[model samples]
Target: MLDFTSIVMTIAPELWLALAGLVGVLLGAVFGDRFNSFSFKFGALSLFGAAALAAIHLSGGESFGGLVRTNTFVNFAKVISFVLAGVALFMSESFLKRHETIRYEYALLTIFASLGMGIILSAADLMTLYMGIETLSLSSYVMAAFHRDSARSSEAGLKYFVLGALASGMLLYGASLVYGFSGTTSFAGIAASDMSNGTLFGMVLMIVGMAFKISAAPMHVWTPDVYEGAPTSVVAFFASAPKMASTVMFANVLFVVFGAAYDQWQLIIAIIAGLSMIIGALGALVQTNIKRLLGYSSIANVGYGLVAVAAGQEAGAAALLTFITIYAVTSLGLFAGVLAMRRRGGMVESISELGGLARTKPVLAVMLSVLIFSIAGLPPFGGFFGKYEVLRAGLDAGLMPLAILVVIASVISLGYYLRLIKIMWFDEPTERFENTDAPVMGTVVLSAVVAGIVFMVFISELGTGGWATYAASGLLR
Candidate 1:
């Protein structure tokens, strides 16, 4: 039995963020719009503090009757999520100010969402999982529509809400079935229970719902619109932190609750992986809007991560974490470049809008190109190394067919990724985009540098232990 003090110590980061969110709510109520800038700073600080606390308390154990878990695996996800979320909030202050009314509620909502994602990373029970996911979903729905003045933003939010609710219902029904068939809501209990047909059906439903959350294809209808309609800064956050948290959760539930049924579930995960890659790779080819293209690109990337997942075992889990971390940083860098594309006319969303960007804004163009190359899985970059690990995992697991699909998808993805680069470098110069301010420039450069160099350092420094590989090993052990 765990004492209250021990539980508190274990969940220090979550407690801190929870308190911070409530305080932000109070401040917003008291000062209203005046609190916007301050809220951004405060939210960023609070997230940073949560990251620190998570780092300090990092270790593995179950508490609250095994309803929550604490470990290097979960902590790794939480810390990265908090830090990336902090970066998003820190950068968004200026972007929000420039485009629309910077509401104090936005900051609080982000804080709340971070709090939810923190729960997601640590969730150990079915009820806990549902709560965390819904919290994150609700906040995301609101944030999608945050630019209330725009019909597209409102539409994005509404579509997200309706679809999100449907997904939630499926998840709930699955959870209920799992509980009814397995006789408990605890993941450990469910795993220990017999694999009845009803239980398997429940697991499938749950996996289907989770696929939607991660924007896997066939269930990824909401992604493109949300990416296109939401504010760029918010899209950046959506692409990075939430995806990281959800993917980690996906791996966690699989490894912990469903490991007993690996033989059965592996095929399901593999099928989803193939669909995501095919749809994402093909869908992006026709897209004219850069954000919509990225939306499909993200779906394809999720497929790549799922390939690692289908491979199973410690190596695959390690590859998944490493893949997602590199992917998140790469995405943040890419979107940072996008955020900088605001011109005198307005924000640039179309692919043609970037014509001759290299000639006009060489530094920004170079950074965006580097990120695109990195994501395209080209050589000597983080994305390549990340995919290398994933392919290695798939081959090690004898998933040759999936590996072949991965290669084919990589070839297909080059169509759009290279097209973006070509337009930036070779096309005729268009109207000059807005001069990128210091914060945005720093974000672009920092993300690009991380994509270009940081993962190399991580890979070189990694051997037998450290980071994604080690983190995954810790959980598996």
Candidate 2:
């Protein structure tokens, strides 16, 4: 008989998120139209609470009959994810109140998404991973279209649903092939199987499917369109948390199930990384919309993370975790800067709208510069170190070609980041652009960006420390 206590511990984080989501739904419904202004604040606090609880569990033992494990890495990732979610919620509040209804369903959807990501990290089997992915994806689809009043939002939702379904089908089909080849879906069981005489086709298909989820190039067609059409805050959430969850699960798929087949998967990831880098960097050059640019940027960032995975060593694993950590913070900061833009006296959209922003909003301009520079991989900042570590890991693995491609991609990406900086500081304001008398949520979100940039400065200290090192150890082992 299963001990209920163990089951409770194993699923504690999911349960906490779920409970919080349910409470949010009820409270939001009860408050109805009365608390529209407060909806976002309520949601952010709940997510922050869930993050705290997940951290507490990290210092404890693993649970769920060993099918799910919680440790420092998962905890740290959860905290990062939850923090991003909170910022997403906070940034979206003003937009939601102005453009759409601030409903309870939005908060519920985000909570469920967070729960799904938490489950994915703890999963010990391919089935558990699939369940987690589906849960997260389904909620995300709804969140993408939450602003049903907007044609773009509705279109984004439909596109995401169609593309996401195709990806999920591919993932399931690949999982079946893997089970057929090895007769098991558990990571440990798959690792123990002798695939010596089995066809490599199944493993290749599985890797391709996982690559699709991570938006690694050729499979990234839907990303930019969706990012442009969906709400900016949702795009920000998509850019960071989901990518981390999906990447971690993909890493688990490779390291745990196919550890013995390293040479084959390593080459595959290297190719994907190269393709993603090229597409992400070149694609962003033509983008005029901030969200679309981030879509392409996200593709490149995933490539960066995959560089570490291709290394197939402990240092590579550590680098992967550290890169995602820095990227999440930078991502949050960038979105906050986007939110800070006032359009027609509201939230601005086009790149041109940022002209002379620095003259009027100096603080926001500086914060935006920090985020853009970080994203561009500039030094004396975290992005620089993050890229350096990944390149070093790839070099250690004798992957000089992939390393070279990463550098080229970063060079190509400079155009957009630099354009933003130039417009803010040099150009004169086209017109008086004051929306809200005061930027409330924008300020709060920028505070998060500042925190992310500060954390980057101390990356070396934390990257090699207890939780970060320990988390990397688990993935490699």
Model 2, 39-81: lDDT tens digits are 6677788778777777766643455555676655566677778
Model 2: pairs clashing at backbone N, Cα or C within 3 Å: 343-346, 343-348, 345-435
Question: What are the candidates' C-alpha RMSDs?
Answer: 1.3, 2.3
Q: Can you tell me which runs of candidate 1 are displaced by over 4 Å?
A: 462-464
Candidate 1, residues 1-477, lDDT tens digits: the string is 548877886788888999999999899889888898899999999999999998887775667888888788888889989988998888888889887668888888889899889988888899989989998999999999999998999999999999999989998998899999999999889989998999999999999899999999779999999999988888999999999999989988888888889999999999999999999999999999999999999999999999988888565888888888889989988988888887798889999999989988999999898899899999888899888888988999988998999999999999999999989999997787778867878888998888877876667443224577667766755
Q: Which candidate wins on TM-score?
A: 1
- Return the top candidate by lDDT: 1
Q: TM-scores, in order shown? A: 0.98, 0.93
Native-vs-model 1 lDDT? 0.89
Q: In candidate 1, which residue pairs get closer than 3 Å at backbone N, Cα or C atoms, i.e. clash?
A: none
